[model samples]
Every structure is written in C-alpha cells, then in structure tokens.
Target: MTTRKIVVSALVSALAGGTQLAQATDVFRLEGFGAISRGMGGTAVAHDVGPAGMMTNPATLSLMPDGDQAMIGLDLVTTDIKVTNKATGESVSSDTHSNNRGPYVAPEAAFTKRIGAWSLGVGAFAQGGLGTEYGNGSFLSRATGGLATGLDNSSRLLVLNIPFAASFQVNDKLTVGGSVDAMWQGLNLDLLLGADQVVSLIGANRATGSLVGVLAGIPGLSGAHFSLTKDKFLASGVDAWGYGGKLGMLYKATQDTTLGASYTLKSQMNDMEGGATLTAVTAGGQIPLTGKIKIQDFQMPSHLDLGISHRLTPQWTVAADVSRVFWKDVMKDIKVAFVADAGGDLNILLPQDYKDQTILSLGAAYALNDSLTLRGGLRFASQALRSSTLFAVIPATPRKHLSAGFTYAFSKQAKLDFAYSHAFKETMDNTSLPNTSAPIEVTHAQNNATLNFRYSF
Candidate 1:
C-alpha cells in the first residue's frame, strides 16, 4: 500500500479501538468536536476548526490555508454518575449505587487538503455514547430477592463516524460542502425488568401477535422478573453498520463576519445481533436460557444547526449557534427480541418518550500573542428524555456546561491544542418504570478534556 493509504488504515484502526466507551454531554452526542471548539463551548458551525469540521460543518474546511493538514487527537472523559432506587416496600427498598465505568478515552484523526476552490478530507471520529454499570449486590438486583443475582444492571451505546467530505468555493463569498459518512455502532446491556413494568410497556405500545400471547400465558411469569444480558463490554458487543451524510454551507457576509448552517441525516442501520442470556425470575425458580438477541430499530437522531461568527477585533473572535435535534421521532421506542436455543421466544420494548432538544452555544477566542490563543464558552440545552422514564443505564440529563481551552504554537507547522469542559450535576426523580411505590432518583455530572497535535505543510 502507499504511504497515504497506510496512514488512513492506521487511523481507522485507532478510531475503532478508541470509541469503546463514552459518556456524553448533549444526551448521546458529545459537547464538542475538537479541542479548539470545545474550549469555546462546542461551537463549530461558523468557526474553522480544521478537518474536524467534517463532523460538524464540512464547508468550514474551505477556510483553512491552501495546503495539506493533519491532526491526531484524544478525548479524556470523566463521569460522576449515581443511581438511587428509593422504594417503600419491604423486600426491595435500598440506597444509592454508583457506576464505576469511567474515565474513558476516545481517539480521532483527520487529513485535509485545500487546492484552489476545492477542499477535500477524510476523518474518523467517536461521535458519542452513554454508559453505566452497577454490581449485582445492588438494590436493582436485590429487588428480585436473589432471583436476579449475578445479573448486574448496566448498558452502553457507542457510535463512530468515518466521513469522506468535499467542499467547493462557489464564489468569493459562498462555499458549499457535504460528506458521506460510514457509521458504526455497538450496544451492551445487562438490564433487569420487573414483570409489572414489562406488562405495562406491552400495553402502552399495544404490541400484539402470537409471541406476545405466548409470553402472557407463561405460568408463574406474571410475578417474575426478566433479565436481558449480553456478556461483553462496550468494545466487543453486538454491533451494526449504517450510512448517513451531512450538508453544510458557509457565507462570508462581510469582511469579518460569517454565517453557517448544517443538517445531519438520520442513520440507516440494520438490527444488531449477538449472543445473550435471558433469565426469568419466577415463584418456582430462576430460569436461565441461552439465546441469540436482536436489538431492533436502533438509530441515531438527525439535527440542524445555524450559526454566525464575527471578529470583534484583530485579536478577538466570537461565535454563537442554535441547534435542534429531532429525538422524539427516533427515540420513542427500542425493541429487543430473544430466541432461545432450547425453546421459547420473548420480546420486550424500551420506551424513551424523548422530546426534541434545543441547544444554544456561545464562545469567544482571543489571540493573546502570535504563539498563543485563549478560548472560553458556554452551552445551554433543553431536556431530551422525560425524567420519569430515566434509568441508570441511560442518564442523559445535562442541561448546562462551561468550557475553556488554549492553543500553543511551537512553530509554523506544529501546534498543540487543549480544552476542558464541565457538565454540572443534575438530579431527577423517575417514577415511571421498574414499578415501585417510590421514585428512582438519578444524578449525573461529568468532566472532559481534549488534546490535539496538529501539523501542516
């Protein structure tokens, strides 16, 4: 293979290995794209952040200097997550339990070349994910009175994107660009559901057919609990591949001001299939069955962003963005089916009832000197999922964020960029599922850092 091909292959492998686990800020999506963008509050639609823009606004690639540029970056994420199941019952009431999964790490790489009016690039990025883990001894498992022992409560969702993008400078003031992304995603789950909750979901969605009848007729099943577990980590779990794309435009409205916009299409993915164990806790005993599991219709949501950036002075620049994500259309329900080896089949539905989300970002960057730059930003977002339906496995409840970072140039061709961000703690009472007298309280908070090494010729 040629040198360029080899580099691309290595970068792809690195990205695949790096997206094993991630805790995001904007529900399942990350708060930022690159170090520079993260420092200034996850703003990328109007500002230029090199090849990383392919994952944000591909048209921004046109703003780079006319040369070859490459970047390798890593994101270090730390999460503070705790789940509390407060019940008034006698056998299942318990205290708070913590998720000991992270700090996590995700790697990314991109190469872009600008020639005349056309800019082209290829890049790999860990778009985002959600994860949480609790031991079997916790209240979630003990709620089953040892009927669900060894069945820990956990879940993980990982997504990665590889985009081949191209941008054209339509005129002196307008640039248009787009990218075709190859998407890959994986899921790991170890969830235990009460019999009452399962029955409730089936009624809520009006699920029908012979399979549903068979499940309802099973003896001693009404008072039982169900556990769906795939014995794997987030890295090597049941996975699927899909395709999606984004369209973007940049308009140089004036000498120092620019307007930008982008829209991402929802992913088209196949069902994720893999081996799993299904355990049923009943009055008679615990029934563990070996089976193959299928996660059906799990797809990411689509979103649109509008933004503007302007240079206040020779050394200061400011940007703002408004975004809307169509979550309700995609996250309403997720179905899982299990076909046992010995006999029997079962199906269940996970209801999200998520609403569309709106986000606002504001950031500023200052060139302190020729060799150094400073950045800061703030982000506010509306709720995506209803708190009453929240669970430990998916606590997507971050509403506000603060971020800061800097870029230090060592020479003309090399620079190091770093950024830090914090998602404040959010706690909510979930009284919807896992049917108990009292509500389940979920608290989540996070901190993140991005470091990148950039080189250009």
Candidate 2:
C-alpha cells in the first residue's frame, strides 16, 4: 500500500482502539519498535541509519554523519485481563478486543547531519500512551447473581515531543552529545457504570427490614412496597495539555562498546473541566444529575534510563537497559471540583494515589550475513498498582515480556523490520473492600507485534 494509505488505515484502527480510555491506568510500557530493535544489538553509529536508534538514543542521530534520514513505523498489541472475586471464587476476563485494537502505531521521523565540529538533529515521536476495556459479561455468574451490572471504561494519552540535539567528538575514541526537548501532550478519559443488581439488593433489604419494623412498633411500614430502578452513571470525555523536557548523553569507550543514559522530567498538565451525567430514580421520579467537574492539574512521573551495548564479534552485539518510573508521585488522591448550575461549588470525590514501578530489559542481536539480522529480548515490569488503590474504572495487569525480531537489508539505504512480543500470563487478587466480607481478585496477560520500513539517504 501507498504510505498515505498505510498512515490513514493505521489511524482509523488506532481510534477504534482508543475507545478504551476508561480502562487505562497511570502505569504504561516503554518498549516500542525502535527500542526493541536497539535491544537486539544495533550499534549507535555516528550516522543515522535506523529509526529505532533515534528514539532509543537520540545522540546516535549525530553519529549519522553521512546522510539525512526519515522513517515511519507501526505497532500492534494484544492483551488479556482476568479478575477473580476471591470472596465468591468467580472470575472475570477481557481481551484486546476487535482484531487486537489494543496496539498503537508510533510514527517517527528525524533529520540529522554533521557540521565542521558538531552534529545536530531534531525528531518527533510518542512518549507514552495506553488503552483498555472490560465488559460486564466477563464477570462470573455467581458474582453477578443475574444482575445486569457491568462497567465500560476507556482512555488515551498522546504526546508530541521534539528534541534538538548536538554531539561533539571529544577525543579519538570518545564522543558526547546532549539534547533539549519541547513536548506537548493530550489526554482523554471516559467511564460508565451499571448498578441494576445493587439496586435490587437495596430494594430487597428495604422490604424485609420494613416488615420486621412494622411487627414491632411501626404498623405503616409493613404496607409500604419497596421498589428500585436501575441507574447509569457516566463520566464523558475529558482532555488536558502539558509540557516537559529531556536530557541525554552517550559515551564510546572503544570501537565496540557504548554506554548511554537519559532523564525525562515529568510534565505538569492543565486542570481538566468536563460535564458528568448521572441518571437514577429519586423520590418516585427519574432524576438526571448534570454537573461539571474540575480535575486538578496532575503531573506525570519522571523517568530515568541507563543502558550499555557491546559488540562481541564482527556480527554479534548485545545490550541491556534499566528504567525507573516514579509512580508514587501519581499516587495522590484525585480531587474533582463540582460546579452546580446555580453557581455553587463543591468537592465531589477524594483524590486517588498510585504505586511506583520499575522495568528491566535485556536483548541480543546476530547478523547472519551482510543482509540479514536477528534480535531477541526479555523485559519484566513491576505490578500495576497496589490492590488497595485499584478501582473498577481502571484495570491493568503487571507484565513480563519476551520478544523476537528480524531485519532484512534490501540495500545499504533501506531495510524491512518485523518484531513480535508475548507478555507472560499473570494474575492479581484483591480482597480489600470497605465493609465487604468478600475480596475481589483480577488477573491479566498481554502481547504485541510490529512491522517497520526504514530508509536512509
């Protein structure tokens, strides 16, 4: 297909998958096609030749002193999430629905070259994003008890970052570079809840309790008929914008060994304002509650990345990386300011906090010949969040990743790349709910695949 067609088709698929905005949590994965490629053993040259290298290490762009290069790539992901209610011994399941719409297509483009004494370049790419959905039907029957209660949640985060970098050759065997980044980001979220079963339970309790009261001292209570109507509560689309910066460095100890590190500061977003609609039966009539809520500015956590790569032979190279995400910074309560139509204001819900996380990854690559290369790697990430902080509105599983990829060089200027990753199955059990005798448990699994076409001039 033409490049335009591919971009359009990929966008349509991405939007359909974007519908799961409510199920996304604060935690996200950093692995992408570029990093996956680098993880396999591609050395960062003083010249730009691969799309993966630009994102994995922007300083590598300055290494490309020969020609200016640009690239576009796509990624596809699949995930499986299961939650078991430990109280009742029942399970709930969800998947990367609709042809694995769970994946994202990340497009990258960069321009770089070397001057008499400096190498400079600029590029744009996605920094972080997430999507997930859970159907009520996934809940076990014993837990649901034939009640039509379910949840639908969706969310998306998009970031556009441009980095200007320059590299200087300090010595015969060493090079150093630094970058200043300007970033813009967007966020969207939606949540829905169906509580027919909870309403029925409330109604039944009212009737039985009223009868007992009438037999004692309240004669009129026994004659009252208890009734309840199901209600649907929904929080619609909310959006926000933010800014941040990144700094990085690269060191070449020898011709075959390289070390790199980078730090990306957190972006502080503008407060979000959106309307919410709550439908319910109140005092013998259907009442619709409509109001606007102000979500305070929330800051995304900062990231620390360290990596090392070494060439073992003329055709073989290996690399490893460690990343730390300060999720604890996100673990504060989210406060929503409510504004009444009458012009009064109130605090809706208390703020919510999240737990911290860490990720470790290692990869290797081998060149079969001048034209064929193979890569593989492993990544392990910490759990999504503490059970005490998890909510039905957002469900996620901690993940362990295994991946393999290959590149076929059509020529020195072009190559075709393919990668596949499978997330090992893992489960989580929740037994802590206020005033509940039974605890809820959730389990999850995830996977992804990607194809990239790269060219350098």
Candidate 3:
C-alpha cells in the first residue's frame, strides 16, 4: 500500500529465500545484463536489445518496437578458482584446487510500455557478486603455533537491483531517460586472520577502536589470531538495502549510427547488521565468544559508460562501449565492528586499495535469415585489484573475455535467445606483500550462459 511496504515486499519476494553466487567482470559488476547484450560482448547502451535497458541505459527503451513487452532471462555462471598459500622458507604449503561453490543461476525480468513519445519500464536483476568455499581441512583452519580449529573458510556476496525507469523522446534525434534504483545485498564471510594481520588490526585500532583494553588486559596472551565466522544457523546472512540513480542520453548522429552515454551514481546504504561467532586464539587458549557484527560503510562505486552502435549493412550491425568504474573512491577499505555479549568489542579494517577500472567491449551481429541471428564479441579490461591487497576469499581478477550466441524467432510476437561467455584464466602471486615467503597465489577463470524468452502482445 505504501512505498515502505512495497520495498519490503519486493525484497522478501526477490531476495529473502534465494542464495545467488554470480561472478563479475569489472570487479563485482557483471559484464552485461541480458542475453542479447551478453551475446554481443556486453554491449547495450546504443543497441536496441530489450527491457534489460532499465538496468543499463534506460533511454534505449524508447527504441523498442511500439506497444507493450515482457521478458524473462536467466544466467548460469560457473567459476574455477585455485588458491595456494606457500611459505618456502618456513616449509608450509597448502593448495585448494577448485573449491569454489558455483555453477549458480541468476534471474531477471522486465516489462515496458510505450505511449507516444514516452516509454516507461520496470525490471529486477542480479547485479553481481563473488564467493568461495574451502573445507575445514584446509590450511585456513590452522592458527598461530599450529593450533587448528577445523572450521571451514568461505565468503559469499549477492546484490539484487530493482529499477523504475522512464524515457522521453525529446526530438527525432534525441532521447533522454532516468531510473531510480532499489538494491538489496547479502554477505556471508568466515575468515581466519593470521597472527601478523591480527596484530596489525590491533595496532591500528589501539585507541579504543577495537577491544584494545581487553586485549591488552588478557594475561599470558601471546601470538594472537582470530576469526569472524557466521553462525551455522543463520542461512541468509548479513544484509542491507541501498539506493542510487542513473541518467542516460541517446543521440542519433546519423541514419546508420547512434551514440549513447549513461552515468550511475554511487550507492547509499546502511551498515549490514547480523550475528557472528568470534573466535580469538592466544598462546594460553582459544576464547570463543558470541556477538553482533556490523559491516560499515560498504557501498558500490559509480561509473560512466559511452557507446556507439552502427548498422554496417542491412544484415549486419556492430557496437562498441568504453567505460570506467571509480573503484578508488568506494573500495578503499572495508570496516567491521563486533560487540561481544560476554565483555568486549573488536573492530577490523580490511584494505582493498582497488584502482579505477577501464573496460572496452566490441561486438557484432549478423542476421542469417528471416528467423535466425548470430552474434560474437570480445571484451578487455584493465586489472582493478592489486596483488598485495587481494584476498583469497574475494578473487575478482579476470581481465579478458570471449563470447558468442544466437537468437531465433518462432513468430512475430515470440523469440528465444541464448549466449555463452568465457573469462580467460589468470594467476596472481602475492609477491608484492611484505611476507613474500608465504605468498598467496590465486588462479581464477569463469564461464557463463544466458537464456532469455520474450513475448509481445
């Protein structure tokens, strides 16, 4: 009945029960949204793809054929990850080969209506996320002085987005559009901090930031380490709501060429609140405490995209997009605070130090006949994460991608599209960190497919 009720209902129906583990290209953001865009190398801005435009460049919704349209899409993502923690001088080596939990599915839907010069649309989609799962036998279970807790190591994050968008055809050659976005995000993490990292956080938060006084008060506390683990009973995990907006412009520079640009603002979200099991280890013994955790100041970055679509011939079309993500602004650090029920509080800051990302996508489509079309594309991206700060739990580092797909029309009002993409494998050795003897090496690659069915009445 009311706006607050509407958002709450939407989140419950859309995100309450689902656990998504989708991979990303420009960090935690997907390379593309819809099947058509994925089939053509994540190109969408100027290409009249489909209602998924509500999540990309809403101005393109005006380019859809007249009348009402509805579409549903699904993406299946599979990721391969291998992590190796080796300390040559210390003779400690461990490797987790393909321990990621994946081959996950993401769903999307949209409806759009065109009335005269105005186009209105609404859509929901899985923006993107990252995850990994390592068993209890993994090296991550061991603490300082060879103490083993036998707890698994894992991390999962998912973001779902809803957009209400509108576009206006200002003139024969110009169109503009905007969308207000509602976003829901879920995060689950179980990380084991090494003795050195624990010491670093303690020093950084010494002035009452973390449980400094309590830690300092612990007698016989030497060689300290710890972990913040999610309770086994909490399935959905810590979550929060976020909001942002996007503005887009489309211009028909020529009969055969169209240009498009869009800007998305940074997201504003509250802290993620949830329960966690905090385990603190010391030379004396292991202290297990129950507490509430607040993940603070976690927000998505802003970005700008510019693209062009050109009809080279009656049977062929091509599109190219260049974009930049301002990660340096939002991904500086991740801060978390824990208040224990027993008698203490702890604060931790995880450094990200992500650089701005540059992405280039190029794609081409050709109509083979009246009912069939073929597409292929390539995407290139500059590395966004530095090896020194890259954590094994979140390895979003692929830099190149190749994709192909096809579309088939069953009738004037119905069609099916399918696309598949592969991210090239990459390996990073964390030799840049101070402890080069125990460099963490990660190898990651991905494959994903998108299927969409659309109908118009």
Best by TM-score: 1
Lowest lDDT 10-residue stretch of candidate 1: 89-98
Give per-residue CA lDDT, model 2, range 1-457, as digits (tens).
Answer: 9654554444334322322222222255345435345334222332223534544455655456465454555555565666566655676555443222244444444455667556676665555455544433543311222333232333444454556666666665556666666654444443332233223323434212222322224221111111111111111234455666556666877888787776667766677655653333222333344566566665667777777778899888787777777877754655545454534343423223566667777788888998988888877778747666455434556457777888888988667777777767765554443211236665655556656665555
**Between the candidate structures 1 and 3, which one is better when assessed by lDDT?**
1
Stretches off by above 4 angstroms in model 1 are 1-18, 88-100, 144-148, 205-234, 434-438
If the candidates were sorted by their TM-score against the true structure, best first, what order would they fall in? 1, 3, 2
CA error at residue 418 for candidate 3, angstroms: 0.9
The residue ranges of model 2 lying beyond 4 angstroms of the native Cα positions read 1-26, 33-49, 52-56, 95-106, 109-117, 136-151, 156-168, 178-236, 278-286, 340-353, 434-438
Better of 1 and 3 by TM-score: 1
Candidate 2 minimal-lDDT segment of 10 residues: 221-230
Give the alpha carbon lDDT tens digit for every residue of 1-457 in model 1. Answer: 9644555565566655644466778989998888988998989998898778999899999998889888888888887777765664322211123332566677778889988899999888888887776656666664333344555767677788889999999998999999999988888777776666657766766344334565567676633334443443344347789999999999999999999999999989888878787666675766677777788888888999999999999999999999999998888877777777876676666677899999999999999998999999999999997876676668889879999999999987778899999999988777876433236777888899999877777
lDDT per residue as tens, model 3, 1-457: 9643443344345433454557776689888988899989898889888888878899999999998777777789888887776663321121232233566678777778899999998878888887677655655556655666566566777778888999999999999999999987777777776565565655655224446666556654433333343433223357889898899999999999999999988989788888777766666676777778888988888999999999999999999999898999989877878888876787767777999999999999999998999999999999999888887778889989999999899987778889999999988867542122246788888899999877765
Best by lDDT: 1
Q: What TM value does model 2 have?
A: 0.73
State the C-alpha lDDT per candidate. 0.78, 0.52, 0.77
Q: TM-scores of all models?
A: 0.91, 0.73, 0.90
